[model samples]
Target: MSDVLKLEAPLGDVIRKSKLKAIKSIVSSFQPINNDKIEFKNNEHSDKNISLDKIQIVANRFITIKRLGSGGFGEVYLAKDKNQNDLLIAIKFENINTSRPQLSIEKYVFEIMYECSYIPKMFYFGIHNEYTVLAMDLLGPSVEDLLNFCGRKFSLKTICMIMEQILRGIEALHNHSLVHRDLKPDNFLFGLGMKSHIVHLIDFGLCKNYRHPLTYEHILYRTGKTLTGTARYCSLYTHHGLEQSRRDDIECLSYIIIYLAKGFLPWMSIKNSNRKKRNEKLMEIK
Candidate 1:
């Protein structure tokens, strides 16, 4: 038995070394983009003059490859880390001068939940030029994107597998005393490369600590609060202007699962130009 164990140990070591060598070779062969001549866009409408140099490289390491998407908070870009074997990363930029800044709060949440596997690995968070920047692991297409790709619906087996991971992710956040107020299909994204099947929960701009961090006591229920998340997937309690709890998160997840399976929610067609009336109609149908 001792002789057999010794042989197996050496064989395992050899296999690991071979894998490491292959990975290193692949990384070494990768061609990094030349960012010296890259042209970054500057918004002329902004009062602050954002220079071209400030928006090019972030943290003195990552180079912006291209803009991926933009929302009310800011824009997200595909960047490459020059210091880390030219590894691809996603960088979110929020204008420092914006009236409502949420990237800092998002950064704090990322720091607290860094150990959770379902959370994206935060690489860097700091000020770069006129924007507050956050760099993280580049994730693949979101569940919403996949839904469109799959002709607007997912199979039962696919939904089962996706929901299992999404539930685990929510459980992890709740265990940490946080509630993801903004739970939707767009925020749940698949991992890249070999981890394509792994689901990652993102967009913590609206997340909140639902309990006392140290004492673990839940927060007091409140009323007459403005809605904090997407109206479509939010719980009934949220629509009623009540504080969200762990149950609200689960309720939102249930709505998301139903949407994935059915390809559309009943209230999706509510298109009243007035936000208040639209929400009222949605509440009535919901």
Candidate 2:
């Protein structure tokens, strides 16, 4: 068994908060990115579908190896950088014609947070044929994947270590006045190779700036809006359609920690076939 699993109590009991605070501020420059200035051109041929089998090369550099996985945004592929001695990378493609395009915002977030420890490095962002493509550092399995591998639960010490990194990641974003609207186990992935122990926050498709970049003003709280994240892990405020702030992100993280430690959540077993009714039940139970 690993030493991390041998521990009985949470890591926070041993680590000093002051030391963690110092560590969290190690990444300098918390300047927020201006959302208004960034502009992405709509692909005129966006009506055409993206066929991965036909797309061997993207942006004339990375060569697609195979699809890694997919989500509501689009598909991710394992690729190699031919110009960089076949350096492996992950490329994500979002259909340009989707009702809600998120790749542009995701790319902008990566650009602004390039120096942050918990963020993946973005290499290329542009339109490829009919899809908006983003190439970045290829990461390893998600926490969800590892949780399943570990029989759906994590040791207390392991959970503490994971939450520490996750907290840092969320702190980095919150410091920049941004909120990751979608916070779930699937979006928290492990780094690759020697950095495998490090945790990275991914899938910023639903990320939003809760405060104005220039004025540093907080966004107004409103309700009766549609939910933005995975229903199981989203916070109560989010399920109720309120504008998400940093608190919602932290609330979702708390749910994630509990689920990792307990192997399941109370709302995970809801089986109402009607999606609307099921979400209503989830909100009630959650």
Candidate 3:
């Protein structure tokens, strides 16, 4: 969400009464303060969906403005805050999904990387009504839109810069043991003019704090789900949900770089499994 949402996130004690017992249960299970990985695509659970019959907002001071985007979860709102001391924020408001855990996990991960220059800073997070709201810094245009305008053409220097920033963002996440399994140009944002652009890591909705063991089935190994990223940039293990690390981010970014430089993917020559075919085309890139 950016300066582009409809249902905005309100500040202060906007959280109201809901399934108190269930909320407390989840908080307790996560142990209030035992750091765990954030869930972008959380497993569906029986108690995932809950009714919000309780909760209230304290600093209820927001002015609704426009719609950013809409999807299965809910609509994002771009709004202004009279009490925000003159600041812009992107608000994400989703209906109660006590079963789903992505927002909660996103709050934690965004908070952790809030200080990283490579990532946007989050402003606030809370659960209100039958909706969970996450307020964050207003980032700009999506890289996909930018690419459409640039049209398969970019200087090698620009590609290198983008790759560097992507690396920095990935390194920041890895340093904290977080894995942004879903990475593509659309997840990145840049300034309007594109001259002075900043690549933001957004949509923590699918992020994973992968739990990898150093050793496995007779050898040192790792294990995890094989939730593939965008069809264009994902790797083999990423597609299989096997394992993810800093290197995967690099590989994915490489796809963007090649796309920008050549106006077409190297893999255009082959049409096999994205992981297999894309990997085969890697050598021809650059």
Candidate 4:
């Protein structure tokens, strides 16, 4: 066991104030896992923990069948488009505090990298009355949720198979020099039924695009920030907001594989953080 990262600080408050204006400045910047020591700042005010009904989703001619789920940036819904097309689309509604340029970047990234089997194909993205929303092909239950329902951990064979498919998807992003900075069990869908099921890569909202879509010389503007991924599985360079490489993806992939084999996170803390000292104790071993 090791020092695990957890925060007493009300991070939600800080996020809202940002209005998610910057590209890589969101919660993804906060290393949420093995970073271990967290020094809380009580300087932020919180976003109103509004009731679910407070925000609304209105798509043209599409009726919401049910809400698929919500994430740090937005909630995805299952819906039917016009002409009664049996469409499974995810609508992501980002709060003012979450982001908007994410919508533009996601479109440019996924739209260009079409044809990878596992990455959920994006249909369209645009502002629906000042709110940034995305429509992606709705995917099935995520692997993390499935593992919980499976009761026991996955078979080694199953884990390998899932990893293979995920790598297939990651390879596409790697080719484009983009990083799915937020890779986790929760981001993959293992599909439904007895036959071969589809495994999909979902949620590119936290994706890191290296192209630097706009022109700005600021370091954060030049590269990117580690704004939206979990720390346990995040690579070291990503912690510094550097655009990730194929090597970095491999590192994160290693962490997830280890997590599946063991029942807990590999770097999880057994004691309260002593992060300031002996932090690199495990570095030499790795």
lDDT by residue (33-143, candidate 2, tens digit) is: 232332111111222345577656887899988776565447777789988899988887877777556677777889889989899888899998778888888776677
Report the lDDT of model 3 for residue 234: 66
Residue ranges of candidate 2 with Cα displaced over 4 Å: 1-4, 7-49
List runs of model 4 lying over 4 Å from the truth: 1-59, 95-100, 192-196, 210-228, 239-243, 270-286
By the lDDT metric, which is better: model 3 or model 4? Answer: 3
Considering lDDT, where higher is better, how would the candidates rank from best to worst? 2, 1, 3, 4
Per residue, candidate 4 scores C-alpha lDDT tens digits across 156-266 of 665676688888888877666566666877677643232125566765645554443354222233244422355657677655555554566688889888876664674
Full-model lDDT, candidate 3:
0.52
> Residue-wise lDDT of candidate 1 within 71-90, one digit each (tens)?
44576777899989999887
Off by over 4 Å in 1: 1-55
Say which prediction, candidate 2 or candidate 4, comes out ahead on TM-score.
Answer: 2
Highest lDDT: which candidate? Answer: 2
Please, what are the lDDT tens digits per residue for candidate 3 over residues 4-33?
111332211111111121111111011011
All candidates: TM-score: 0.79, 0.82, 0.66, 0.65
Count of clashes, each model:
0, 0, 28, 5
The models' CA-based lDDT, in order, is 0.69, 0.70, 0.52, 0.51
Winner by lDDT between candidate 4 and candidate 1: 1
